[model samples]
Structure formats: C-alpha cells, structure tokens
Target chain A: MVDPEIRVVTIDDLGILRSVQEDPATGRVVVTITPTYTGCPAMDVIRADIRRALVATGHPDAEVRTVHKPAWSTDWISDAGRAKLAAAGIAPPAPARRDGVVPLTLAVRCPRCGSPETEQISRFGSTACKALWRCRSCAEPFDHVKAL
Target chain B: MNGPFTFALALGDDSLIAAQRLAEWTTRAPEMEEDVALANIALDQLGAARLLLTYAGELEGAGRDEDALAYLRDDREFRNCLLVELPNGDFAVTMAKLLVLAAYQVPLYTALAVCPDERLAAIGAKARKESAYHLDHAMLWVKRLGDGTEESHRRMQAGVDQIWPYVDELFTTWPDAPVDPAVLRPGFDDTVTEVLTTATLTVPQVSWTPAGGRDGVHTEHLSYLLAEMQVLHRAHPGARW
Candidate 1:
C-alpha cells in the first residue's frame, strides 16, 4: 500500500495535511485537510484528487474531510513542499509573523537566481495564493506564494 | 430573521454586490493585467458571498440555499450598503470605491475574528487575511493614479469626491452584532489617511451622508445591477452549470 502522505501530497500543493487515521473496525482511512485559504478554488480539486488517489490505491472507501478550526497559515506548508516550490521557480511563503503588524514590503528571494532583490509586480498574481514578483538580478518574473 | 441570520445576509449581500460590480470590469479594464486582477478579486468576493449566504440559510432554518438567497431576493431584500451597488464609473472611480470599501473591511473582519459566534469567527479569520490583500491592492492603485500625471490625479481626486458621501453608511451598526462598525472607524480612517497622504490626495469633505441599506433602502443603481445579475438564474430556476 502506498503511504498516505505521498498519496495526499500528489494533489495538495499547499501541504495542508492535518491528520490521517484508519478506523479500527472498518479499516477505512479518514484524511482531514485544512485549506490554505477559505475561498481557494484549488480546494475542490484537492478534495477530488485525494479521493481519487486513495480509491485508486486500494482504499476504495476512504473519506476526506475538511476542517476550519485553527485556521490555515502559510506556516503550515511542509519543508518538502517549500523545496518543491523553489525548484519549480516559485518562491515559498515566509513564516507567518505572530505579531499582527503586516509588513509594508515583503522581501521575497527570487527562486530563479536566489536573489533577495525582488520587487512585487502585483499583489494578486496568476492565482489567489500567489503574488507576481520580478527578480532584479535574473530579470525574470516569477510567482511568490503569499504569506497569509 | 434572527440576529446571526440577518448579520450573515448583510455580509453576503455586500460581497455579492461588490463582486457583480467588479465583474463588469472583466474585459473593460484599461490594462490587461487589471482585467485579470479585477476578475480574481471578483471571484474572491463571490466565494465569500457563497459561504456567508450558505451559513445564513442554515441559520434561517430555511430550505433556501445560497442561490435562492442571491438570485431570488428582490433588491429591497438586500442589506448591502449603497457603496457596493454603485456603478463602475471608471478605473479611477472603481479604485476610489475599492479603497474605501477594502479599508473598511480590514478592521471590520479583524474585530469579527474574535466574535462570540464560533462559525463567524472562523470565517472572519480567513476573510481578514483576504481583505488585507484587497486593501493593499487598492492602496497601490490609489497612490499610483493620485500621484501620476495631472489628468490622472484630477480624475482620482474626483473619484474620491464622488464616493465620499456614501462612506458614512459603512459605519452604521446595530446591537448584538458581531462587531460594532463604529469601533472600526478609527482604524479605517487611519489607514485611508495614510494611503491618501502617500498618494498626495486629501480626504473629501462631504456634507450629505447616505444611509439605510441595512434596512433594505438602497440607491436606484442596485435594482438595475440586480436585474442584470439575477436574470439568468431567475429564468432557469435551479439550473446548474
């Protein structure tokens, strides 16, 4: 049987795995997920993917549930996901600041050239979860997953 | 309606109306990037509207879902402020309206995040983050247009003036609400002032204030906006794409 984490990560790019447990009697796996953002359209896709992956991997009766408690933060993205995002030329979000002060400027390092000198082109990027940025060093435009 | 139900409907209507106005800019924005940006913002608002309306339906103990509340209700049944229902006059005007509305939403959601209602608090926590981005986007535009060329600056100022009269309506509140809108005014003012100052613009001094959207009294623009938004859904009646 494939590991549940690998199966779930195949679909959840945000790395929002909260919990996975098997029912002792039914032997059915129940996966719990927390969304990256409340209005993220990717959520439906993620849910469908999880169900498909689990069902295809011999767990035909697996259940996926979404929870809202302890609201999702960018800090939840796994280290592996962060590396994957950078390898894909997308800057992973910085750790969320506990202090409520929102920084006027986010110093996102360019994933293309690993340069700290990056400027934000648009707050709303190609997707709701990212911000468009330009690397001053590489002169290439990229997306930075926003720190929500 | 109960307190939570009414409050949820008001929030849902605000997002729904704002989303409709933003959708009007899909292919009409001055820049292609703005076309995508406005559409994204509109989708965000639509998503929020769906959540709030769905909750409202559950609170009301009615069989009605988000669609019934959104498409079946008459203009008079909506509880959104008049500011959201106003026409998208131009890019400058749209930015001006967005500046005020987004600024208002930031503090409003922040306060609601800790409200007594657990479900509302959860929604508020997520919404607070989204609204911050919306406010930031509006601030950047307001600064660019307000401090740009002479014509752009003048138009930006005029946009502010046109929308200023309706700003007061956003601060109106009722008892037992999750957050007192009046308490959010100071934060809203400070944020707006900082942005306006950076943009080299002044707050407009308006003498007349419009109010009463919470009581179903809205500007004439809302009826037209609703007619256009609801026509398809009303015609089909439970048709799903």
Candidate 2:
C-alpha cells in the first residue's frame, strides 16, 4: 500500500529536474536538473539531495547534471505529483492553458483556511515560482504557487 | 558589422547594450512592484547574455571568458542588432520592444527546447520560462498603453513606429550563424501580427531594413557601453566578488 503520510511534492514542489535516465550498459544513471530561476539557491541543495538518494539507493555511479535550457515551468508537475502535494497540505497548481492562446490567470486558494478569499501581497514571493499572498479569512501570510 | 572581430563583438555587444538599457530602470520604474519586476528581467538577460558571449568566446577557442568578450571588444567591433542597442526612449517604447522580443522568443525557445542538441535544448528550456514571463508582462503593459489614454496611445504608436525596423533584422540569420532558421520555423510574421492585434496596434510593413549583426557591425553607442561594462573587469583581470 502507498504510504498515506509520506509526501511527494510536485517537481514544482521542489523545482525542475529536466530528466532522470539510467544507462544499463554503463551502469551509470544521469539526473538532469535546472533551477526555477536563473540562480535559485535551492539548486545546489537539490543536486546534493539527488546525489545522496542515488548513493543511498546503491547507484553510487549515478551522476546529476544541471542543464539550463528551454528552461523549466510549473507545468511539468505530473498528476500523481500534484495529488501528493495536495495531500501533503500544500496546494497544487491549476491546469495549464496548453493552447498558448488564452492568457494565464490564477485564482489562488488559501492553504491555511481552505478559503478562496485571498489577496496578492507581491508578484514575487519567497521564490521566482511563487507569489506572496495573504488570506482574508484567516489573516495569515502564505505563498501562492505561480502558474507557469 | 565588419568581419570576424565585429561578429564576435556583436554577439557580446548586443547583450551588453540591451542589459545596460534594461538595468537603467532599476528602482526607477513607475512603482516598487515594477521596480523589482524590471530588475529581475534585467538580471535574467544579463545572465543569458553572459553565457552566450562566453560560449561564443569558447567556440572561437580563444582564452577569453565572458568578461573578456564583454569588456575587451571595441565599439565598431560590436555586432548586436539595432533593436537591442537602441535608446530606451520611454516606458512605452521599452514595453513595445519587450513585447516584440519576448513574443518572438516564446516560440523560438519552444522549438529550441526540443533541439536534438542537448545544450541548445537546455538553454532554450531555461530561457523559455523567463521569455514567457517577459512576454506576459509586456502584453499586460501593451494593453494598458494601447487602451489607456490619448497620450499613452500616441506614445505607444510612436514607440511601435520607432522600433518596427529593428524587427526585420532579428530574423535575418546570417549564412554562417550557428543557429539555423531551418531547424526552427521562422514565425516572426505570425507571432508579431497576433501581439500587435492584441495591443490594438497596426503592424507596419516597411522596405527600409537594417542588417549586419550576424556580420558583426554595430552603432557608436556600443563602445561607450563596453567601456563602462568592461572597464573594472578589464582593469582587475579575474577579480571575483
């Protein structure tokens, strides 16, 4: 059974990992990661974490490469990933407009009180991928996941 | 653009000029929210430009890193397209240029993200998000300027007119340029049309076109910018923060 308590945040939950592939012939795995923003400080931590996980998982030969191109988006988060985030008490991103025709807008939900009544405190939140929002009902400050 | 030196210079020079222009708004935009917003954009461009110039230098197999390419090149040697190097005439003009550039970039990077080349796809993916945000911000401003007031409309129109010529040069990929137009669809005409329509402005078609960035030619403004951007680094040579 899937553990109910364990949380798997969206890749947006942490940040972008472009790809994770293992080469059986070489017995080497490569995990490609990129930052949400150009110089997000979390990137180093993520790289280290991936390395630790690989080593701990008996894949000591694994390599983590950070690639910055065609950059990252919040949209890459998988359906299963979003479910994990919601169950973890963190809200998930809304559906992306795949058509690229309609303009993007977000109706941020309050994570604290589960209310829709909220206000944007700033366009930039603690990080590039989030916005600072405050709950009107609970009067608590929170970070809203920006729609990429 | 003149020759090899000029082309190399242009690659770095365009980013330098464009970066400087964008940086001018640091803490000087109409509001605090926008101040941070504009600064973020400037920083993103600066970082990308640095990488591109550094890569260009490496491709040349010269010892020069990003700083050398950015700081050492002379004005006439710079080859950035005119649109980027032009004066940031006003907020309206800045917004207009941002709209055109970012709109072009979105699709450009979208195609680039999937390039068979790993590095290109990586860079394209990284740049794509920033380009999307830049385009979104520009669209918001364009709508505001276009539909706001008589003065805003006048300025917006003027801005569009001033920058129209520069648009043509962005697509003129020189024969020897590393980036191939064939790999990516040249969708400038369609993309620009949609944005202009959304902004409620008429797209202008003109025969007077500018070129030479791919060939390494640039205007007089480039030299001064290089002097300022490169001086401290050139003087110190490998100084680190």
Query: TM-score of each candidate?
Result: 0.91, 0.75
| Local error of candidate 2 at residue B2 (angstroms) | 15
Write the residue-wise lDDT of candidate 1 on B86-197 in tens digits: 9999899999999998898878777888898887888777777777778878998999999999999999999999999999989986777888788888888899999999
Question: What i-RMS does every model get?
Answer: 1.9, 3.3
Q: Best candidate, DockQ-wise?
A: 1
- How accurately is candidate 2 docked according to DockQ? 0.29
Chain A TM-score, prediction 2: 0.72
Model 2, residue B71: C-alpha shift (Å): 2.8
DockQ of each two-chain model: 0.46, 0.29
